[model samples]
Target: MGAAWLGRRLDRTIHAISYDSPEDPLGRRVVVRAIERITGQPRLQRIYEAYLAARRDGDNLWQMAAEYLNLTVRYDPAALAAIPRTGPLIVVANHPYGAPDGIALGYITSQVRSDFKVMAHAVLERAEALRPYLIPINFDPTAEALRANIEAKRAALAHLAEGGAIIIYPGGGVSTAPHVFGRATDLPWKRFVGRLITTTHATVVPIFFEGQASWVFHLVSRFSETLRQAMLMREVAARIGAEITAHIGAPIPFSDLTSWTDRQALLDYLRSTVYGLDPAPQRRAA
Candidate 1:
């Protein structure tokens, strides 16, 4: 029963990626399969299977994703405990590893509050298992991203206004080289995060993931952005059974951010604050 449900969901996700249309030719379908095959479609199916099993057994989805990926997430219990239990809250983090970091966030924060939602890439919305937790933003430049993001933006604000929590990756894109000299660091964070912080008066909790993807991952990234995205699952496969460390900084109250009048300045400060959580410089060394 679970396998059947998972297959249907995967089909829907793939068709969505294909942008299903009657005029879509056989070549386009071939391209979709080729891309999917390269992007660890089989491995992702296994992960999704595990997720469905967890849902069936009434277990946590985040925990299932972590375990299936062989990721052992460790964070300071006191830091997590310090999160504001009730009120409008925005958890900002660096996007180092593509999917793992998001899963780690869900696992970490779900322990504190169940009312939080994550702002994620729009493709993830196709996963029925993940829909409840994600507020998707279309990052495709070809699409009308500003218009596409409006609904998600409104949903985030409404959630915060109701005293719910939301998580955001201010960098907007994953960290990589060339974009930040020789190092792997988040791309210049978007100013929208600052706007959300100020607008909702939400307490901001900055969290940093401790490592980067393998050298091969970054090397391929230098060639093509699309190729880099396709290699995300390969990165996950490489890190299987790896201990993923997360550092959670003290929460910054909205009052603390009010003084920063400039949008870029506010985003720069918040980026620094999150990156500051890294305990060692060598961990991110290229």
Candidate 2:
């Protein structure tokens, strides 16, 4: 049965039993006993309660993070206002910083539309603390837990299919690098996002963030690169101060010509747009 259906049935059954005649203390006791029996474990009731509480906590943290970041989103107000009503826009942005970037973008999207989701990394998803607010994308091939990742990806696709907006960091984990500090040279363009937009026929909105993290974090990033394990770099970057200002570009319509070549062209277009907006560096690289 579907989760929504099961939840409805559970709610209806509980309400029916609890409200039945109101005077029968025996009926209320029976309802409690039924719940214990249905759950099949004495500990399950506590677990369920704890899970709900954790979900609320996760949501609260997400809200607080959004407030803390306070991203100055520079876009045409008319365009921003049109996005929620337009349905299922694919928000593409340059990944800067580790924690605040996604949080700020997600918050901005939420302000525009209620039906929005974020495609986050598997590590963040695995934290039971954050799982309630994050839909983890499993990129690992060796683990059997990837089934959840598959389900999450399907959920994202279904949300888009139903005309819901989604925020994705196409640069993946590398954008979280600390050394990226307003530097124009390190941006790595990945092709998966282009494929997603073309396959889903969603309009692409490019966003750019104009800052990065501290040098200590960059040292950790360098260490990870040397060890050939870059995933941990995001966590390192998050530890230090990483602030960014986000800028949204004009939307690109999906079409038949959005092949790999087209994807590269789009990436180039976005890169050039961001590069042009970046201030002239105080000093040129040696």
Candidate 3:
């Protein structure tokens, strides 16, 4: 049920992120056809319906995501406990695993901090179960999308200013080019984190959990991005006892980044800090 719903929403919002305009009906249909061909609408519907039923019966989305993906989530309680429980907190993480990553991240954080909300794309933001925990963001660059962005910014800033904890996937979209950084890495970290910190003076906590998408997901990216995303369930279903790990680092106060002159530099610094926790070459390969 949930899958069917989010799938439809993704079809509609494709233009919101892509070059096409939301008002163009023709563009919408094209996007749907392209994606459906890749994901197979019939299979997508069956998977979503079953997932939705399970989701409705439980308050734990993390477990649902893990079970659906066939993954075993593992995190260090001591590492999570090491985070300072003071001031407004902002978690900056790599957007590798896309949807499942958010669920696991939210689940881990909620265990330590209850006042948690994620800055998510408009699609995930629409999930009724996740509505309470999401601050919706439109990826379009239109005047309307710009207005929507401003509102999202306002809401996120307000939430932080109020000492609430929020999680942000700075990469915005999931990682596409695997060879860009010698491994799968996000496109580019958005400057929103810098802006958020400057305004709210929130403590930025960086964590790294490599994306677990299958090679097929990455290989197919060479063709169509829309179809690649539409077929994420194939990646999800590949995880059987696969371990998802997160390494949390100490907080970096907003003031600490004041000396970083360039905006992109700051974003890079944050991305590297998170990537710093990535498993060393041998371990990752082994």
Candidate 3: misplaced stretches above 4 Å?
1-58, 67-70, 178-182, 281-286
For candidate 3, give the lDDT. Answer: 0.69
Residues 244-279 of candidate 3: C-alpha lDDT, one tens digit per residue: 778787788877988887777888888888888776
| Model 2 per-residue lDDT tens digits across residues 1-286 | 5655645555454431121211224433344445334432233324334544555432544444443334344444665665535666788766656555666677666666666677777656433444645666765454555687667767877777888777887666544343435342334766656666666788777666666555444565565432212222333334323445566566666653355367777666655554444444552220
When sorted by lDDT, best at the front, the candidate numbers are 1, 3, 2
Note the residue pairs that clash in candidate 1.
none
The C-alpha TM-scores of every prediction are: 0.85, 0.61, 0.78
What's the CA error at residue 122 for candidate 1, in Å? 0.6
Cα displacement (angstroms), candidate 1, residue 73, comes to 0.4
- List clash counts for every candidate, in order: 0, 0, 3
lDDT per prediction?
Answer: 0.78, 0.54, 0.69
Q: Highest TM-score among the candidates is held by which one?
A: 1
The candidate with the higher TM-score, 2 or 3, is 3
lDDT of candidate 1 over 169-233, digit per residue (tens): 98877788664235688878878787888889999999999878777778878876555665666
TM-score of 1: 0.85
How far does residue 28 in candidate 1 sit from its true spot (Å)? 9.1
RMSD of 1: 5.7
